[model samples]
Target: MRWMQRTWIGSTITLALTMLFLTGCPKRPDVVETVPRPMAPQGEVGMPTPPPLPKVAIPEEKSPTEVAAQPSEAKPTTEAGAVPEAKIAEAEVKPEPSAEGKAAAEPELALKDIYFDYDQSAIREDSKKQLNENIEWLRKNLAGKVTIEGHCDERGSSEYNLALGERRARATRDYLTAAGIGADRISTISFGKERPFALGHDESAWKWNRRAHFTPSAK
Candidate 1:
């Protein structure tokens, strides 16, 4: 009976030691579940892809340079009928021929006036020099035609002075026609006791009024 009691006691102690060993060791921590990260798109099975790159521009190769034209060598502008620039420049610079055998420019007056005595239609000796000068001027301007105006002082009857003025104009015309001026190129008019020059009633005014005046005739 004592050997059984001892065997029972040994079994109880062995069970108590196993329970203490299991309680004495530290406990393992609780396992945590991790969230998955976002990923780039897959091109194939495993590799991820980026955005496409822009196209690159390549420069073209240049052609070889040709020989330049010389300075003296001018190119043709038109067909064979066209005149060259050099010839045109020459024509522009070339001087023209002047009028042959022409005299110098005409004098400003071309012809001069002649004075006469009161109540006389005769040409005076002093008046001869001026009359010759008028003839020379008329000859120079061959295209020129003239009219002789006979003016008189405010004296005598108007009718009498008009007759005298006509006589004076005719006498002057006769002198010019005889001196080689054309008869057709000469004309005579009488303004008797009218168109006085000096404006007073003296001999000085009368001498200037009684004269032959010349003017260019209209064509």
Candidate 2:
């Protein structure tokens, strides 16, 4: 009986020691997870570039020579910018004449007469009507040109007579213009008692000298 109890106690003690050793032992480490790196592009090894900017329009400047090459806008004018309407009308339209009328109308100008003033003067009143008639005749006949030659009585100095003769001629020309004669066809010169129609030292000679003679220029 004593030997039997001793053997059972020994078996119980060994079982207890085995249980204690299993409770005190360390545990094993778990698995660690890892992520993979991204791969590079096939052709290029850098980042993508941005798109290029759009093109812009720029204006060009005109040179001075180019500006001058442009056409001008101003119009030309006649002499002194004065256009004579009556002269233009006369040139544009002409009147036909009969046979006798043509013979009479053929440009024939003559001084044919002498005008007189009181002694030592160049004033006349009736001469205006005659000068107007002569101018009208010249305009109607379409005479190409006419000249007025002025003279003075042999009483004043030669220079004074020449000046006075010019004054008379100018007065006659102005009257003719007022009577509707074209000034373009009429001209004036001064003889100043140099060319006398009558050969005498009397009133008749002075009368002839103090006149304005008309002469037609050959057409």
Candidate 3:
């Protein structure tokens, strides 16, 4: 009985000492370690690439000579006051008409004496053409004044031939006035057998002597 009691006491003291030793010592905390990761390239190494943008055609720029070679809108060209060579020469030089040409143009204007039959005051058939020509001349020269001298053949008295000559002169004046000549532009005179164009006493001389002569004067 004494040996069992002593063994039980030793076992109880050893269990108590082991529990006190465990309670007296402090516990240690757990330690955590952080690991650094390696950096990757752009878009992660094996990412898919987007499709290339649709290719657009770009026009090339042209130089001055190349642009000028292209056809452009049509524009009207001007002479800029430049006269033609032919016109300049024509303006600078002109040829005057000759005196012979003047004579030709004025031949119709030369006043010709219109003859009458023996002791007649009426206009003769042959004298119509000559009278018309004289009227044309007077019309062309509007500023010309005319004197119609009436003549007679040497066959009557001085007073009687003068009356006849006056009749002839009046007849000539009437014809001229009726053909559009102004009466104010004409003057009448009697030269009854005083001035004879043909001196002989024949039909030719008498015909020439009995006439109306036109003398023109410029205004």
RMSD of each: 16.0, 24.3, 25.4
lDDT of 3 by residue, 87-195 (tens): 9899989887687676456653377778888778999888888888888888987887888889999888888888888888888889989999999988898989888
Residue range 71-124, candidate 2, lDDT tens digits: 999786567867688888998898876766764665453233336573333437
Q: Write the per-residue lDDT of candidate 1 for residues 1-219, one digit (tens) a residue.
A: 999999999999988998898899877878898879667466856765777889889876555442333245777568778887889999899775443312234243555667778789998888878889888888978988888888889899899888888888788889998998999988888888877878998887888888888777864
Clashing pairs in 3: none
**What total of clashing residue pairs does each candidate reach?**
0, 0, 0
Please report how far candidate 3 places residue 193 from its true position, in Å: 0.6
Q: How far is candidate 2 from the true structure (C-alpha RMSD, Å)?
A: 24.3
**Clash pairs (backbone) in predicted model 2:** none
> What TM-score should be assigned to candidate 2?
0.46
Q: Estimate each model's TM-score.
A: 0.50, 0.46, 0.50
lDDT of 2: 0.71
Indicate the residue-level lDDT of 187 in model 2: 90
Candidate 1 all-Cα RMSD: 16.0
Q: Model 1: residues >4 Å from true position, as ranges?
A: 1-108
Q: State the weakest 10-residue window (summed lDDT) of model 3.
A: 100-109
